[model samples]
Target: MAEEALFAGPAIRRLRKREGLTQAAIAARLEISPSYLNLIERNQRPISARVVMRLVEQFDFDPRTLREDEAIGGVEGLVRRFADERFADLGIDREEMQELLSAAPQAAAAFARLYDNAAPASLAADDPFAASRREIERWRNHFADLDVAAEELADEMRLSRGDMGLALVDRLRERHQLSVRILPQEVMPDSLRRLDLHARQVQLSEMLSAASRNFQLALLIAQLEQRDQIDAIAKGARFEDEAARGFFTRHLMGYFAGALIMPYGRFLRACEATGYDLPVLLRRFGVSFEQLAHRLTTLQRVGQRGLPFFMVRVDRAGQFSKTFVGASTARFVNSDVSCPLWHVHRAFERAGELQVQFVSLDVAGEREGGWLTMARTVEGRGEPGETQFVVAIGVEAVLAGELAQARGISLRSDDAQPIGPGCANCHRVRCSQRSLPPRGRKLHFDTIRRGVTPFELASS
Candidate 1:
């Protein structure tokens, strides 16, 4: 490789920053020192092939992503090396250095660097979400490709044709002569695709509760029976690189996993049986509340859906780890998506209460412009104070009317008094709940806004 060969440092560094991590944080993820990390990031050191292998395994980076020709070169990589909190007044804080080194957090420091890197870019944009998105577009692209494939498969499988999942499943059983079994978590994980290779049966685990096990089992059977066909569909995509391709593969796999849990037809029945109530579905399907919420995102199996839905689960920080789009019409902002009035935050407010929400855009959607639909709350399963996830599900403008529960709700996306993504990204102009000024617009610097919403958005 040439001396100037790209080490993918910039790309990797950008990803870490977007996730709000630092070199020391990355080192912690790999159990190394910041000095060692500095050397590697600066290209003063080269990440051993061993470390590269570890990055893929640890962060789920595609091994190919590391093979690019970009130099660990740019000043950012150097910035990452010297970018210690101890020197922050000079853009790196001195006191924070000791903690960063000793405590060795996995991502906090890296996130700081990202702010330094993108802050200027963000300030230039009236819309921080658009800028933030540019920085992490790869992540979205990966999901986009997979989502496209999933949708196509959904269409071909005739998911929208009503009870299509069962019809396809039935056909597979008849043709492949495969048996389907549903076992509880106690008996078996949520599901498995048993493929015997050399007499070694592959046990694919779904980590589902009992009743959910049955629902997912049927889906897995359909996926398995069509495994080759699905693989072909995935391979047919026009991917940019192996790394991007691999991440998408994993995501699609997750979708299939979800489908198995809530096979189209039966799930639609359960949706009717329980009035599309997630809690009721969880109990009926014997799955976690999160699992039930996640499964709902896959309702695009064509004709069997109750209503088009988009599932979002987040914390107060506006960070989203799970996004399921069951309906095309409903869309979510990709960067800095925190909202207080949004059902997700409310879910956290009523942490354990299974409140059947009837929110329209005005009730929980953005409080400004566009059509929006939302449902939110923090749900519990294990013991108290054990890291329960705050969650919310929603439908965007295009499919807003398809909502089964949106009767007499806000008609516009921003009808619900909208909130901003944490103070970091929301552009809502006068939200009393402003956490921080939106990531972009200059702060008034007058009557200290002192709010949770971060933006000076258009509406109020």
Candidate 2:
């Protein structure tokens, strides 16, 4: 068995600083020598199990929160930020970066925030869609409040297979006095759904599949019945601008539609029984792949929690259409693009093929570990300009044992293939798969000495 990484030294030091406690005071509390605590804080020594227990016992700290706050993911973000072109002159090495992360995580995060604010007035001002994507990326693809609200509503509704669609249709007709109509393709050209507010009618394209029809109807029902709740949640988010708020409001409605289709309790039971097999869940629930994957990310009930999964949808050009993350430690940021080597990109090559891969991501010297991921390419027809995309779903490597597709895959953290978020933020040197040098790197021209790497990224 591999040893558990002790990566909470920085977190411990931060906790001490917040409490205004000295190294000596914390050392006495943990029953360790002051020098040992100092070493741990310096990233030269790992925090021992005894120290962790002493911390929990003395300070009433939740172990999970501590682990998450100190995870290598945070360090990875710092590595990405430091790799920006503006910081190239600093010449920060991996070891020094680790020391900085371990000793002063709060300060590290503060600097990252400052860099974010100081770098640009609006990161994607010209492109509203890109700006919204970046906004969701900032939240790390998870909205805890939205998840809770959807799950709670699902639990309350308890709609079974086929019942949800009928219920939603009935709710719209009875409560809202709206008529549901599936219009001919030509009549509904360039649109999948349209609401005639004056006529009190909901019109959908006849070309939509059964799953699509049900989802659209359910989305309308959600807007009518859950608008106030969704609005309250959106208002609480305090989005920087109206576009972000509107984008997130639409997202919340989609979450409501998904939860209505796959209620939390039953979905969790089916997921466990089927080992989260996408095909099995789709067959059983009569839902589309995208719907099933979206529902899976919402299995975060208090006691009956399922695997911590995240789902991403991308087009052929590496544009992110949707993303949701459930794992606290395993985060997927900036779904606009990920590592080109990711299986999701390959799945697009062989249309309708299912691809599985295990990938690791390391930034600076800290290894962020691997995840068990599955991707499938999907094609659909809509209006003349309809967009088709591929969807990828993943769970943390530790939960791979529970997945059937992961049966033969090695679960070792080190055995997995290495990947990065994207070229702009990635700092992995000499990666043959690397498309471009990270923002902060200098391109070195070696006319005499040519290495196997295509691009040379110089830190100096």
Candidate 3:
């Protein structure tokens, strides 16, 4: 069988334009003729493996960008966007979507942004969190400046040498001239950590676990020390309002806190050395599983990058409480509704125990790729009673060989369960777990025989 061609014309053209290189200059660098390069840029000719390697070697380009560009403002994204009922009447097809992405990717991105802004008032109103998520996604949840600042502070305090919590508390006291006070739950019923600027004290509720206390301390330090940097980064985002900017700023502070507690260089080395053993990492960091999983998502530091892990925290009802997409191109990572078949939902059933699964995400009945996912339940900090959440982390299947958790798991194994973004966007008509039909697909009634699903989609 002939190998499928890789036609990444738009991506190559964008790269060339970004680098201010003409077709002839880029062709010279890639050892290809200007006419051939032009053909490739116009997508008239398929990009060869040799050219791909040359591009990677010459410009330090990520190979995935050539293939997975569709995940971000590409054809697949347009497909999902136009799948909405609002666009059903337009009847846009896949080929048209692909052409739009290929010819005018910037315009396509702007259209996607316009579509988002055109959402119903009920869903869009007072929803700064969505804007915050977009900003984080734009950065791929990695902030080098914040990580460097946090790592410097961590080293200065020698956090890894002794009790991390004690180190943070001492640093706060000595550096900021603030006293640390652990108040009883009755005294501070609602808040977890409160900074009393007037009293020059940082008060923490007794109900908080040791790990929580440490995290809170680190977060405070981030706010005090990294406020200027965080504000500047948040201001760079195209936030709709101050609420969105504030929400993004708070998330950045948390990112800084996570970095402080688990410095990037140290954490990446530990992760690689331990083969990403979660239990071992949890013990070493003195942090909760959720916190560790979240930290794993920020391991994308260019030259010393770790696995491109994606993290998501979902409640029992399947609502995403928090999510960070490091480098994985999996659309389901940011989907509003996740597939029911994913182990993320099943993790609730086996609380505290890690549930691992190899899942294949499908789009429009076509397989996108495989992923190795792990999920476990974590207790949430809610008022009155503690709420439970499932925190899940996943890396692409190709990188699973590097993880200790993926031992004994074969990527080629047929046991890999097929999943989708969710019932709404998924066109897997035969999925037994599908709760609803796909958004744009019409239902076909089969009175004679019932299929795997209750409703069958018509083959248009």
Candidate 4:
């Protein structure tokens, strides 16, 4: 019964405490008497709809929790409340029950619904997407600036070119005092790691496949070995999405793996040594092309991070496998939207035919920008499996040097296509192929003329 309050009196009291406001303070803000506000907060007088709205606006509390009492089961709470034997003995009192429900309103209904949610009944359960989303968000914030860490680490470890895998192992043992091993896959059983931080020793079975092996070992070393450093960098980053936070977390584990496998300074020199050729680096390092590509995105630490590139890897169908950005790439402001008319689709037709293209981007509250895009298709999995076109999408401002090195075709400045992985989330203006309007904007149509884009910016 205590938990059943739609806005529970106790929760309101707690909210006041959290904000460090007395009843009088909130009452003044609401232009209500302190005594009246106290009554509503205590569940003595039911909250008015106006107060519910005001709580949402003032405190920025989740509307769903605020309306929990007004939800579907809340009305039934009031019905059951006065459903005494004497009232029921009066026989058919359906109209009376309705009147009682009307008096209780959203509070009763919301309480009932929330009660049903918390109930251990077999059939009904609330979906936990929100919790999962939050976890994912936390992870993203955890590893937002891995590239910076990797770059700064290059000098501290005294690593200069050569085999990154071997050199990183030597440094980890000497500098971090963490033991490194390359156990054969068959040697260890089910367990991946056995850590004793007091002893500062971690033994991981090399039983993991190529990607998994590198990933697990590096993450363990990062967390147990350099937790404070990683956490410090992550704590300072400002994240926009919850899933991005989770992504940052999951990706950081991998970032540590990359740092371990291909230490920054050595890897940067290797990129220059091999001229950023994906296959050459893979054959030399025995890592997957995808892993190498992921490393390219994290090249932004101090003086040594390679070209500050906005590394986006998408296949023929416009599926993004990985996305990374450096400080220089961050400065390449985006047009709150994207265009789909770009020639990336042709890469699917002309598989393996490397193509250079030009695109225009308009940043909101700013002017347009230019970019050079490099796109190509690569075979995926094995021979029988379908060939894939992995396009390395990037901007022109950051590409002058790379363009000069690999000059196949000049990127024309006049062909004003815009960048877009897909239309549903794009924010470009006047795009004929726009399937949806940019998020956070109201789409309005005018009687005089229809815009090329399906949705037009609404005016004040």
Question: lDDT scores for all predictions?
Answer: 0.47, 0.70, 0.80, 0.52
Clashing pairs in 3: none
Query: What lDDT score is found at residue 259 in candidate 3?
Result: 94
TM-score of 2: 0.77
Q: Is candidate 2 or candidate 4 better by lDDT?
A: 2
C-alpha root-mean-square deviation, each candidate: 18.8, 5.9, 5.0, 18.1
Which of the two, 1 or 4, has more lDDT?
A: 4
For candidate 4, give the lDDT. Answer: 0.52
Kindly list the per-residue Cα lDDT of model 2 for residues 251-275, writing each as its tens digit: 7788777777776667778888888
Question: What's the distance in Å from true for residue 417, model 4?
Answer: 3.4
The C-alpha stretches of model 1 lying farther than 4 A from their native spots are 1-208, 211-224, 269-275, 283-287, 300-306, 326-332, 355-385, 396-415, 447-460
lDDT tens readout by residue for model 4, 44-143: 8756445644664566343233333222323333344334454466663547555544445444455454554454443221223233323433332223
lDDT (Cα, 0-100) at 32 in candidate 1: 74
lDDT of 1 by residue, 95-129 (tens): 55434432332243454446555646545454433
Model 3, 345-400: lDDT tens digits are 88887877899898876655655556789999887665533548889998766557
Report the Cα lDDT for residue 169, model 4.
62
Q: After superposition, how far is residue 333 of candidate 3 from its true place, in Å?
A: 2.0
**With candidate 3 superimposed using the best TM-score fit, by how many Å does residue 267's alpha carbon deviate from the native?**
1.4
TM-score of each prediction: 0.46, 0.77, 0.80, 0.46
